[model samples]
Target: MGALPDGVYHIKLDDQQFLTIGEEGAVTVLPAQDVGQKFEVRRASGDNYAISKPSSIWPSPFVCYDGAPAAPYEGTRVRLRVSDFPPCEWKITAGSRPGTFTIVVAGDGQPLTIGIAPIPIFPPFLQLTSSSGKDLGWTFEEAK
Candidate 1:
């Protein structure tokens, strides 16, 4: 109702579709016609977006990649890990809410780098973790 913050926001697109945006300016299209339709917001740039469907509609849990269902206590922790080359990257299309999580990658491979916009422009928690479920010691703090 009031002025929206400077970040990505999700809006219902019809009764079966949704659109997600990213701070880097990407747009993702989601076609969810059923009540349990699940999708993931990866990244967004300009007017385009990227997304992934990890599960079928209904009671099944949804995740970006094949893995165990996230524990309830994990809260908004989006886990990502890479062991090979190709330079893996994850983008968060959801807007900058205080508790909203972007992407968290960790592993024992190449060092990962996180990037985000300057403060007052973007606010999101970017983290990296290890393959053993440990923090990979990387954080992308918003620049002042």
Candidate 2:
């Protein structure tokens, strides 16, 4: 798919694991539950989409180290900042697997890639790695 249509969705890495955004703007992959795993995908002026919490309506905007609107570099930790509200322009491009998509970091003009095999914990999520990897962790399904 080119870009995910504007709507609310539960980001999924598989049938079980889901990407959950915390109140303090921390992102994590959870096993179950529909509490904080939902994000509002809203189309911006162009191909970018704003991801946010449904209840709080806080936008998940990606910011750089200096808190700029540019794409993040490799190994840079990302977080949702309300100050930027709209965040970086994310390009939803086709991923390495079917039914999955790579969230292109418009800030850095590159796709959002996961780190090494061990996987990352909470707090500050790991940064993007090789662009050719199959990171289904970024794949999300439209919530009902």
Tens-digit lDDT track for model 1 on 1-144? 122233323333222333333233222334533332233433334322233333344332222222313222121222232222212334332324443333332333433222221224222322222223232222122211
User: Using alpha carbons, what is the TM-score of model 1?
Assistant: 0.19
State which candidate has the highest lDDT.
Answer: 2
Assess candidate 1 and give its lDDT.
0.29
Model 1, residue 119: C-alpha shift (Å)? 21
Reference-based lDDT, each prediction:
0.29, 0.59
- Can you tell me which runs of candidate 1 are displaced by over 4 Å? 1-54, 57-97, 110-144
